[model samples]
Target: MQSLTNRQKRFLKSKAHHLNPIFQVGKQGVTDEMAKQINFALEARELIKVNVLRNADVDAKEAGELLQQKTGAELIQTIGHIVVLYKPSENEPTIQLP
Candidate 1:
């Protein structure tokens, strides 16, 4: 996956700040189904946030990396149990590319 430009990363971070997570990774971490769902979400939204449940032993960064790998999404940021990812939709995106 291509890395987001610094400006794009900053813009995405600000845009995502107010939105709630669309998906949650629980004690099971990320299942194949969850990965598929994430990929689908990325195709639609380009940018998304995921919540990692407290019971999960995986660190937030690790979870972020795993999700990025599985979904071919960029790891925009990871704070606490929340992860932010971005992947340009195949079609033109409604969200501005920074």
Candidate 2:
């Protein structure tokens, strides 16, 4: 996977700020089904936010890493229970950076 440049990363972060999480990781957290859904979402939308529920035992960083590894998406940012990720679409991307 290609790494985002500092400028691109910053741009993506801002673009994702107002967007709500497309998927939520709850107590079950990062299940195989969840990973598969995330992968599909990333393919349709280049940038997406995942909300980690408070009850989940896993730390945010660990969850983010696992998601990145499993979905082949870049970890754009993580604040509180919210994680932002990016995976450029193979065809057309729904979200565009400035």
Which one is best on lDDT? Answer: 1
Mind giving the per-residue lDDT tens digits that candidate 2 earns over 1-98? Answer: 77878988999999899988998888887988999999899898788999888898776777899899988899999999899999989888766655
Best prediction by TM-score: 1
Model 2: residues >4 Å from true position, as ranges?
94-98
- After TM-score superposition, the amount by which residue 6's alpha carbon in candidate 2 deviates from its true location, in angstroms, is 1.0
lDDT of 1 at 3: 73
* Tens digits of lDDT, candidate 1, 1-98: 66778998999999899888999988888888999999999999888999988988687899999999898999999999999998888886788774
lDDT of 1 at 38: 95
For each candidate in turn, the TM-score is 0.92, 0.91
lDDT values of the candidates? Answer: 0.89, 0.88
